[model samples]
Target chain A: MNNPADLRYATSHEWVRLEGEIATVGISDHAQEELTDVVFVELPAVGRAVDAGDPTAVVESVKAASDIYAPISGEVVEVNPEVEADPSLVNTDPYGKGWIFKLKVKDAAHVSKLMDAAAYAAQIS
Target chain B: MISEIKSSPLEAAHVVLGAKLVPFAGWNMPVQYTSIIDEHTAVRTACGIFDISHMGQFIASGPTAAAWLNGLLTNDIAKLGIGEGQYTLMLNEAGGVIDDLIAYRTGETEFFLVVNASMIDEDFAWMDARKNANVTLRNESAQWAGMAIQGPTAVEVFAKVFPDETLPPRNGIMTTAAGAVVCRTGYTGEDGFEFFSPAAEGIAWWDKFLAAGAKPCGLGARDSLRLEMGYPLNGNDLSPERTPVEAGLGFFCALEKGDFIGRETLARQKTDGPAVKLTALRYLDKGPPPRAHYPVVSADGTVLGELASGVLSPSLMTGIGMAYLPAEFSKIGTPLQIEVRGRLFSAEVVKKPFYKPAPSA
Candidate 1:
């Protein structure tokens, strides 16, 4: 599942890499693998405020659509245009170029409360 | 309330291939083996095999079988010669579809029927209660296992599996040297044959087909392949309250033949014109894949109806779907909107089939 140790994960399969006040969010590799072929990605609009567990984006495979939830409360600062143009990036490079959005964290402490990489791995396993 | 889900005879094989199993119509069936797009492409370009054991099969025989069946089903059964098959529908007294199935004339007095899985019991009960004294109906679903090998290379794969046997002509049925029944027909608009064998020998035959080069496909690919051709899924596209006339399936209803259970209503709708028609729609631009139950709207913001079946076509790389819309909006090139999660995507009513396969070499 290649879940990096530095990133924190939510039970819903999202991962966050906190860089100071701004956090980059994307689905975990394990999540992408489970989704198989990613055909379309609906990114959250920039400047939209979302609470933890709110559905902020959508990822669609051939069979069905899944909502990507906001791991923690934040205001969307940016969304990945690359993923919108080529959704397969989410399946091929979920941690890198496929990152869905950048959020200005409302509470840095809430990010710590989420599962660390080891705990996320254990939870998925 | 918990109910038992039936398992396919090839369940173990699917598990070994790491298939994603999901509950479909009261059966635990494989929805995908690899990815839906990958499997769908394989069937379109080469050969792909699908487990159809969960579907229901029946055998009708007797001196009066053909006559009896014609009175119940919409198609004229007497028109089919021995070894020939025809796609037909069984409807209720009000002309509403009960089930859509393929009827094959296996012998002078015998016919084989392949019906939808969910309607097995209801279909049987309906026919049984009205069966003539000279007709005998038998539900042989549990005794047989079925597989459909479809694609441009399907015939070649069939030859490799049964070297000595020849497949029947299109929509024809013939028995093999090993007592298996092979029907030359498929839902995917491709050259293919459906094979039915004794239940216990299912795994062996599946392996033989795979060894002969048919890629394993599941229900997910099956849905997309059929929808590409604009074929209706019984539960999704055809239903008890909708008649064949409204569904654009009047061609299969043989209204000129004689009186059938649903003939009167169909005849009336055929002459007066159905109020609503099952229409096909395609996306004008890139958007999320359309799905069933998504609301379909008009350019003027009128809520026409919801999609009966929808999918993102792998061949066309666009969203395509079907919905029952008012007659005024069912014409080809009519602009429409598909609402998904409060967002509307631009689309238009296209022709029946969203895709057409190229001529076979």
Candidate 2:
């Protein structure tokens, strides 16, 4: 699976898409593939404060548990309940409907420091 | 991941089917193909096959084989007739389980023993140190590859694979013309057969079984299937710190058969009862699934013990797990709590086997 060209990625495998002040976050396709058969997801609550690289959420597969990290500093404005109810979406459509949470950027310029799609693709490979 | 993890003969086939391979018990084995729940449900409903080549297999033959085994194992080996098998356990002097295994009486003086993969070296060394001059012990694990074909439709698939052969009945083992040992047994609660063949032949059979409509399942589904049946995993539920008395596997341990390795300790535990008892539990509140090593506590906030095995039971669609709790707190319907990631959730001690086999029509 290829990382979406429009999104920025973190070293921890979370992808971020910035729309004005709101930054949407989800795990990379490679991340979901590694953690196969995701049975449950615990999304961080809306209004929670998170800094870049913070362990913000959790994804659990049948075999193990992994922490989802924050790519940039922000306050969580909304969390995707759909992904929480059906965690497999993170595998099927990781970048779109499977977006985990949306954060109101505390520092919009920090997103520029995140890795590009090509860089993430190289890092994972 | 261990750098020296061994790969099974079916490794190529597993990769071709897009299985997620992981290191388990020093073997690089497939953990899942699609989703664990999907593969688990397939076995419970239709059919599924697993590559269980990592487990250890041993052959003991000679005039003294039966008597030596009787001295080593907790089960009544004398009662197992030719072509029959019995579940048994090897215990430490203190009555702690070394490993749980199945011993098959193939001939008048020959027996086959199958033990857990991780405990192969330990089990062998322990037995080898006490080796009798009359018994011959051979480790056949590296020479053979094993497969478990399971479910209600397993017989049909087996028939398709061996069109001219007769399958063994439950608890029976037969050596095939192609040098494969077919045992009418499985870990999944469903009716199935476990086949062990030469490494090369085993890979071919795995492919043929898939072509014949048997789903290629992995260790993930195997764990859930066995857990649903309340089967105790060797390293997890059965450990050096636990005995058959606490595991609720006393039926397999026959004290009346005479003195075995841990006979005295086991007899004392049987009469006096054990301090810890294994119990089945299901989550009352929906949240993240319980996992091994998670703390299991009493209603009054007393820590009982840690969960031994846990999973989001695919068949029951609920969180199910097994834990060794204090005997007083192990009663059915007793309220308990599980602490996962510092959050407590409601749970209860329930009956054995969270999943039951459907009644035959």
Candidate 3:
């Protein structure tokens, strides 16, 4: 249930860490915990353009599939192949190695509007 | 803003163990305790205990119970000796499956039926509509709590729990001294037994099994285990629109035995062949797991059918599912494509079971 204070999150449970013009995106720990076992992840291809609120990826558990929505509109700069190979990384370290994709921020200022760790924590609780 | 959902007798135990509860068929049931793969693996390698109390239970016993059941069910009830259980189907007049259940002959003229939770009300009404004076039908779901202890090590765990008792053979029910009926049956393709006891003692049994090393499994692991075995789930794999023949469960439908509710249509389908038969699909290439309602299509991309149930098999370490496919493309090794989130993944029609138990050393 750790929500790093530095990270910003979405109402849909995605978390983003922005540095300069790049934003690293993954689901929150609460999201991974709710999903239970992570068996497969379908990440957006690198360089794909995505809008905020758009489904950018899919995380599948043994029971069902869930869409991972983009927190901020941007072009995908890179994808995390590690979580793709072993989906449990998302469950084990959702805020770290489980980072799904990096977005080249189209509007870096828009990231500020998302909820902070405390706000996101309150939203889930 | 919300109405109440029924909880199992072991709901408190699930909460103590930190289970994730979800609404399933009008019941607040646990979907998982830990991860699904972890629980699923435990059932395959060791033993896992599941609270199946949401399923419905009914007692039908009287002067003409056996005869009435034979007409109401697809299986030949006359053949089932006392203590023996057989998987059977209740069907609509058109041969569509109402629900799949297991009927256990408990005495010379007494029977017990276990049916899907979602269909309990409808199933009861259907049976009652055909009821006559000679039989008594009672809905006993509230009085019992059911638990499935399943896996390779299930026998050992049962022995540890009931040290002095001998479990019934497969498909047999042994009434325990404590009034619990232990049935040598399970949904997972492994050796195990399902225990039905008075509702009040369910939590105690759940805790005792957990203390004895049985993993607390939820519906998530249950889905994956049964999917790997190609077992037809009531709502997902079998439905009022699907017949037993189309579900690849013709063996359970005793057509020649006598006329049942849906025998005419089933017999015709058996002779004419089902247009679309339930078949198993295994991923030929690794990708996102196929899920329910994902379209199954041909190489040319024409939609043939949709996946009835699909999951990433914890045992096979690959995606597996059951779907209705045209009889022409239902053979083993037939190449097929499953459309998952707008992408077609390579898959093939495989044998029913995507996993098999390891041979004993």
Candidate 4:
């Protein structure tokens, strides 16, 4: 509930924050709550091209496995090596330490249509 | 994941505490509230309570009820004293298991059976079709709620909550002041009780236990605990097409007893020898965790069997699973291979009760 205002969300529960030409991506609080207890996350290879709405990374919990879809089509500039070393960071602070990758957005205009804190909360409700 | 909402008696309470509700089988139940390891350890070292309300409860009673149950169950129910419970199996005519259950003999003419939630309707029909007027069978699952308080400190917690009367003393049934059917029986291979009460009263009793200081455990820990004990879940290890003969649960079947519903088939299988037996496997190399239906291969990577149940055991620190492998591979220390996520991982067939702690050792 840290006012997800600055972060933009996808219908699949991922969040993207634009920083200059780079966008930091990770799952939102609602997604982390639903996934629960992140055990192991398969990191995206740095410098890989990703398409939106497709599996870019995999996460395995004690219960089941899931895929994290790329919120926007992009080229992966860097992966969070810390998250691969400690996956629980996603469950602790999904917005910060849990960021999956930094993507160079292919279409910056699409970010405007994504939900903010208020709209994302409304969408989940 | 399909996240359609369904409510159990404690649905509101679980939502309030931010439980990760998942669709298990058919009901929406909490998979875990916090971490699976924390809850799993809580149930092993201390105490954890579970809302087993989704399981089915049944009653079959009358002058003929005992006789009917004798024919239906593999165990010798007639041998049980009043207030005693015995593990039993209901089988199809082909000796395939219909469901595995625990029957509590409330009296000579009264009995209570706890069965898998998913098979209640079919099992009830099977029992009813074979039932005679000397006995009566009724599905009481909807009217009752089953809750389990498990682990080493279970008795202490129960004693504090119900100080007025004796709770079941270690696998014994004892009436409690809480007006619940308290049985010291558990599936976790630990000291605990599975308590049953009217459905409406379950909510209050669940709250009462929590207020009295019991941790609410979820399905995640329950699966891990039972798996470690080599207890085959009904749907997984004991399927309708599989019999005690194939599942390595023949110990619960009494072949010498009087004729039962599936006695003939089971007897034939016993005489011929079980072609396959349930085997335990542990991964030798760290890899993707094995899951149900994953194939079990041989030393040279020949397919032997498929996994029946698999889980990441925090206690074992590896992927432990069960499979119905050929008799040759059922021995302890049988090195085998498990295909996890399409990759073969070196695994060994181990013995049951894999990690029995020193107290239960």
Candidate 5:
């Protein structure tokens, strides 16, 4: 429920934090807690182009696997290799170390379209 | 949307203890409280209780209850003694399993049976259609809720609450302090008690169990426990399309009995040897947990079978699973490959109860 000031959220639970043209993406703490003991994380490869709302990643919990959709259309510039090596990172710190990928946002202004910290907190709480 | 699912009587209590709910048998059943591994380990090493009220129960009684039930189930009722709970399966006339259940004779003409919640409707219809003139079958599921408290220390937890030997000693049944139909039984590989009570009162019973120092566990831990013991759960491991014999559940099939709905069919299949036999597979290393329906293939890439149930065994601390493989490849030491996430992982067929049951179970 920590509404990190730098991040925006999607209704589907993905978080996006814009830094100039790049938007780092990951899931929220509320999400990891619901998923429980993440065992596997499938991250989108760097340089891959994704459209908004597309399935770009997957996080597998002990019981089930869920899709992590792309929050906004962008090109993947980098992915969190740490999560691939250790999916439990999502459980430990989904917002920081567990951030899935760095996106080269198609439009930096698109960040405005997503849920702000207060709105995302309202959505989750 | 775990919260979107309906809550059980114990939902609030479960959330208060930090349970993770998942859709199970049409209800939002808690899959775990702390972690499946931690909870699983606790039940195996100490004591744990589960809110299993979502499981369906029914009462069958009349002048000819035994005969009527014998005609419909796969087990030999003649082998049962009053107050003793027996694990058995209900099979269709085609020899396929309807559900794996427990039958307990509460009286000379009365009996209590538990069935899977998902199969309640169909099970009721099937039992009703097969009812005889001297017997009556009633679906008592909606009125009841159940709890399964299992582990080496399980008896101690219950003893504190329902003392004076209110529990059925070592797998026996007795009325308890909570007015529960306390059955000494369980699916976990441990000594345990399963309490059946009014649905409205289940949450209170759950709270008492927790207060008694029993860890609150859920369906995820339950699944791991049963799998570690190689117990076949209905619908997943055993289904209407697969006979108990093929499912490696022949132990529960009473071939000595006669005239049950699937008696002749099951008897023949038993002699013929089930075409596909259930086998336990242990991943060679600490690999990803196998999943249901993952293809099991021969070394030459021939499709041998498919995984019926699988998970990272918190008990074994390694990936474990069950599959229906050809009888020829069912040897305990056979090496196998299970395709997971579009890739193959090496595994081995091992003599199971993949986990060793504590001496108490």
Candidate 6:
């Protein structure tokens, strides 16, 4: 599994890359592999406020649907339209073009408190 | 209250193929080898092999076997000639389905039955309690390992694997020189055969089919393929509380044949019409794949029923499912909604099968 050193991750397998107060969120490679062949993605609505651990989106495969949880409390800033048109992007490029949504962080420090690449790798390993 | 999970004879082969194993019908079975869609497409366009050892097999013999089975099963066993098979159902006295299976006349007085894995003990006990003196029933499920090789290319793969043997006609059963039984039948609407042999030889036969160009498929692909053809699954689409009539399987039930268990209720339902019908539905727009137990709603937002089975059809690239809706709502072109989580997606009642395969060459 590729755990980029610059990105922090939640135990739920979502990776967040913080830029200023904006945190870009997407499921990690390990999560995408577990839920293979993503056929549909339900993105969270913009401006929706979510607390940490809240299920903000859904990623579905042929077999079952999974909840993509909010790693940290934030307001939904933007959602990825690319995944909506072609859901396979989540499986093909989970970390880059497959990002699910962007959130305006409530507290930017919370992003640092989450697991770093090393700790996240250890947990998944 | 925990029970032991059963293992297929070919479990080791599945592990070697890197299959994702899951618990299904109290057995550790592979859900997929590579991916459900990939395997499903293989079975649709090429050839795919599935380990069906988890299903149950039984042998019934004696001079009166045919007459006796005809009384117990919904199909008229008298119609089957030697080496012929037909899909039939065993039902409770109240007309509810006990199990749906294929009964093959392997000989003049002997019949072979392949039943759902979870219904083995119950089906056996139900039959044994009512068995007549002239018939002898035996459960040989544990002695056999089964595999279904299915697809348009299945015949080609079979020819490559068994160059000396000729495949039986559709719904026909033939024994190979090595004592293996090959039946020209499968759940997927494709030209294929289900092979059964001694339990110890499962992996060898599996390897032979694979070497002959059959792709290894798991329960996931098997499910989608069957559902695409609108085949009813025993535990999912069929149950003890529902009769075959409500399941849209009246054609398989021979009402004109003499008396049988559950015939009275089926006959009554056929005349009076079932209040609920197992209706097929397709999503009108892109949505998350529907699944069993999802609440189905009417146009005016009335809760009609829940889905019996549902999936994002790998072939159609749209959500398709079956639900036991009220008879009035079961008609074709009726509008419906499938509620996933809290969102309601529009769907419409359509024909039984969501897909149709190309005719075999």
Candidate 4 chain B lowest-lDDT run of ten: B2-11
TM-score of each: 0.99, 0.96, 0.96, 0.89, 0.89, 0.99
lDDT of 4 by residue, B213-241 (tens): 67888999899889988899987888877
Best by lDDT: 6
TM-score of chain B of 5: 0.95
* Candidate 2 structure quality by residue, lDDT tens digits, B259-297: 888888889889999888999999997778899999999
* Candidate 2: residue B112 Cα off by (Å): 0.8
> Which residue pairs of candidate 5 clash?
none
Residues A1-125, model 3: lDDT tens digits = 79999999999999999999999999999999888788899989888999999999999887778999999999999999999888999998998999999999899999999999889889999
Better of 2 and 6 by lDDT: 6
Residue A119 alpha-carbon offset, candidate 1, angstroms? 1.2
Q: What TM-score, to 2 decimals, does candidate 5 have?
A: 0.89
User: Could you give me the TM-score of model 4 versus the true structure?
Assistant: 0.89
Report the lDDT of model 2 for residue A78: 95
Better of 1 and 4 by TM-score: 1
lDDT tens per residue, model 6, A1-125: 79899999999999999999999999999999988889999999999999999999999999989999999999999999999999999999988999999999999999988999999999988
Alpha carbon lDDT of each predicted model: 0.94, 0.90, 0.91, 0.83, 0.84, 0.95
Q: DockQ, per-model, please?
A: 0.89, 0.71, 0.83, 0.44, 0.37, 0.87
TM-score of chain A of 3: 0.98
The worst-scoring run of ten residues by lDDT in candidate 1 chain B lies at B352-361
The DockQ-based order of candidates, best leading, equals 1, 6, 3, 2, 4, 5
Candidate 4 vs candidate 6: the DockQ winner is 6
Docking quality (DockQ) of candidate 4: 0.44
lDDT of 4 at B7: 59
